[model samples]
Target chain A: MKKGIFSGLIAVTAIMLIGVIMLTSSANIKNSGSENIAQGIWEIKKEWNNARYLLDKATTDALADSANTGPCTFALDAAKVQHYYMDTIAHIPGCTQAFTVAATAQAGNYQATGTITCSKKISNDFSIKKFEKPAVFTKTVSVQKDMPAAGDCTVIITDAQSGLVEISRVV
Target chain B: MYGENKTGKGFVFSTDAALGIIVVLIAAASMTMLYAPDSSWQKIFQSTSRSMADSAVVGFYMNKVPADMGLETEIPAAVKQGYCGRIYDYNADNGAPGIQSAPMDRNYCGGI
Candidate 1:
């Protein structure tokens, strides 16, 4: 009689121990999963920063090209800058990027600006629950601002997304 | 004698208690064996992350030179110790590489 009761007690105790062990392990698994998500976010941040740097470098390089940039009246070459930007982006991953370059002449001074954006969705099972969301970035470069030598040859631009940047702009 | 009487009526509770402890220990040991290799991989991944981050900072430094000088390198000791990689400097024209060399410890005050 007593043997049956003691055996039942032992079984119950063993089962309880197993329950505690499984619970602890599952909790650990979830914690490590969250850690992985954190690392993924870091990788994305690094990639975006890299994208911004390359875009800026590409703009500077194109502006240095003497073939297209000239005096206040003469327009700067937006096409060359776009080419450099696209070429620079190919080196980095996860940043399918975009850019805009515009040159304007006014008051006997020329100013030009180019903007590049690198963005990505940073989501996990938590945080960003939406199926589709946008992570955005935008940067601008001005030919005259960085190159003081472009004085009379200067072109200035701001968020010039719709201006002289578009290839379809009429002369 | 005292333990020999436990769970009292006719059965000795000591045997049952021992059996329960054995079950618990077996489960615990087996679980640890399953997780040991996983923890080692996690360490490798963590070190790789740190190394990549260090490399990125070095690249950032290479670009941030004084306007007058073509390049400036003044890596902090903390970052220097973690880095032992070569740097390659290229012309924007994307021509043949002009300078490619590993940083010497002597250049940064020598300890590392």
Candidate 2:
């Protein structure tokens, strides 16, 4: 009787060991496959966020450049905005916080590569190599409001008896 | 006779204990296999993937990604890397995706 009981116990232990091994191996395989799919999903999500971020950054940068650095006075500089927006998005060289957009279809071709430290700086290179700081894109500089060089008209009159004076100035 | 009966009874109890232990182990293994990603779990994963694709389509819209570029350049480029799907212009009949009528800056993420 003692011998029979001992053998039965050994059989039960073996069965348990086999079950444990099978369960562990199955779980490992299942987890690895799930991990791969999860990684892929995460990558796609990241790319979408990056694309959106690039677009938003361009818009904000363009607005800041247009409002702060103007090719016009009391008006948003459309030309500057357009130039800044295009150059920022297209990754034109010589722009602060900018990187190159590779023409090839390789991965991460348009990845941003530098720390952006521009505080209160709203101007971009605008890809205008012929003229740096051209008049139309000069930061914090206004077109001369008092430039009356094109034409000027002035009239002055004084009445002799009443000593009344009248003046008209238009430029 | 009584001594033989006692030994037999002892042997039967030991065998019963062994069988009970085996049953317990098998039950535990079956429970684990049950939790593995079944049909419903797969559906969940597919739904999540589709949602991510939808977000990418939204990025194409807003004209930031350039809808024309998405259809012309990106979809093909993405497809090369295990990506599947087509970019359909929003509510178009003639399917000119020919300078896109009225600049429909709309996109869908997944094919189905």
Candidate 3:
């Protein structure tokens, strides 16, 4: 009878050990996946913020001149942001690939949750460069209204052609 | 015959100690994530001042002057009372060239 009780205790200990191993491995995997997604989200937000800053700088500088008007043409100074994006997200130890927007389709307005695929665009070298190769990233983003009351506003991006994006208005 | 085992201790885990340690660790981590005092103040002043100044700059560009004016010039004057007063000279000559002067120079930041 004492021998049987001792065997049961051993079995319980073995089961607990297995549970510990499984839980630890699963937690590690889950953390890694979450960190990757977080990195992608950061990349996208940083890229967009850089774009906005460039636009602001260009417009403010152009404002000093008399020739510029409502919409102006400025080379997308994407190189600076792109280079950083590549080095950080691509070269990192665990990062698989850089985030991307879909090809044949442009990045639509910011949404709370969505996907982004990579696309090809002319690099600063003027030669064809695949941006963040395997240029496809799909991620979720949260965007809120960016306008004041009593006035309607839309973000317009233009160089040769114009792209006007409308944001949500909760009111 | 079944008998009670009086000599055995049921469990050894210290639930209170574990919970207290976990709570302290979480609080420490959260505090580490919080902003430093100077940075926190800068963020507050930056957002408020930038919004005010940006709107003022835009309005000046668009010809939409605010009614409760004179704060722009007053700010520099207030600074003059505490400093070398070089800002007074800077305030005097800071208007945008070729653009029309604001409706009132009374609110100018630099001396006018």
Candidate 4:
């Protein structure tokens, strides 16, 4: 009888240990997914910021030389914008694994808008999960200048789902 | 005397085993309840989304110089021929629903 009791206790303890391991594993998996998504989004944001800085520099150069010419407008070629998009993706850490980035630009009277979209596939390593869908991050920026000369620029950035993220008129 | 106490010993052992099982089950239940998946995911999603949104805003603004400068022209051109693909079409009336109208107001710098 004593032997039987010891055996049962051992079995129960082993089972409990397995339960704890499984619980911890599930938590780790979920946490990993969350961290990856967050990290990807952050990398995209950083790359986008870098591209914007480059665009600003290019625009400043163009504006500085604008005084020589009579009312003339210049825009980056679509291919050039595409090039920047590709370069940004290559440079951003872990972006390629997480999502693909696409950018579109639109020019208006005194303002221009740049839109960036990052998309990814949702999947699990072990099992086939249901309700799996692609996750996307679509961001847009509208930049406007009051005067012709180089100075402060008004910028507004927004996400399709989220209304507005940043709004400032600084150089 | 020994045989008489054997039965009582068996009873005590059985009771101990039952209590041990219950304790294990309670521990398991508590562990499961402590880490709710919904709350964990919710916290992560909110934080990540907010960060992404903030980054988009700042990125757009930083790149605006070139975009605005690229749009600058001495001579006005047709909207169709304008530079960059125009996302928002601003008019005298209600200037672009979501965004703050051009010539930002006093409260423009309030919330991120």
Tens-place lDDT digits, model 4, residues A32-141: 67765655444444444443433322222222222212223333233443343344334333333223334444332112234433333333323222221234434444
Q: Estimate, for each residue in B24-102, the C-alpha lDDT of model 3 and write its tens digit.
A: 5565445434412234454455344434544444444344434333235344554422111001001101223213111
How would you encode candidate 4's per-residue C-alpha lDDT over B33-89 as one tens digit per residue? 665454655555546445444443443455452223333212134432221211111
How many residue pairs clash in all the candidates, one count each?
8, 0, 13, 7
Residue A94 C-alpha lDDT in model 2 = 29
User: Tens digits of per-residue lDDT for model 1 on A89-165?
Assistant: 66654465655555434332223343333444444445431121232222123334234554433333222332333
Q: Which candidate number maximizes DockQ?
A: 1
The DockQ-based CAPRI class assigned to model 1 is incorrect
Question: Candidate 1, which segments miss by more than 4 Å at Cα?
Answer: A1-6, A66-74, A104-171, B1-10, B14-17, B35-37, B40-55, B58-112
Ranking by lDDT: 1, 4, 2, 3
For candidate 1, the C-alpha RMSD (Å) to the true structure equals: 9.9
Error of 1 at A8 (Å): 3.5
After best superposition, candidate 4 residue A77: deviation in angstroms?
21
Q: In model 4 chain A, which range of ten residues has the least summed lDDT?
A: A60-69
Q: Which residue pairs show collisions in model 1?
A: A110-A154, A110-A155, A111-A155, A111-A156, A112-A155, A112-A156, A112-A157, A113-A157
Give candidate 3 regions above 4 Å deviation: A60-171, B1-112
A-chain TM-score per prediction? 0.57, 0.33, 0.36, 0.41
Candidate 2 on A80-152: residue-level lDDT in tens?
A: 4445335443332222333222112432111222222121211221222221110111112122323355432
Candidate 4: Cα lDDT at B87 = 15
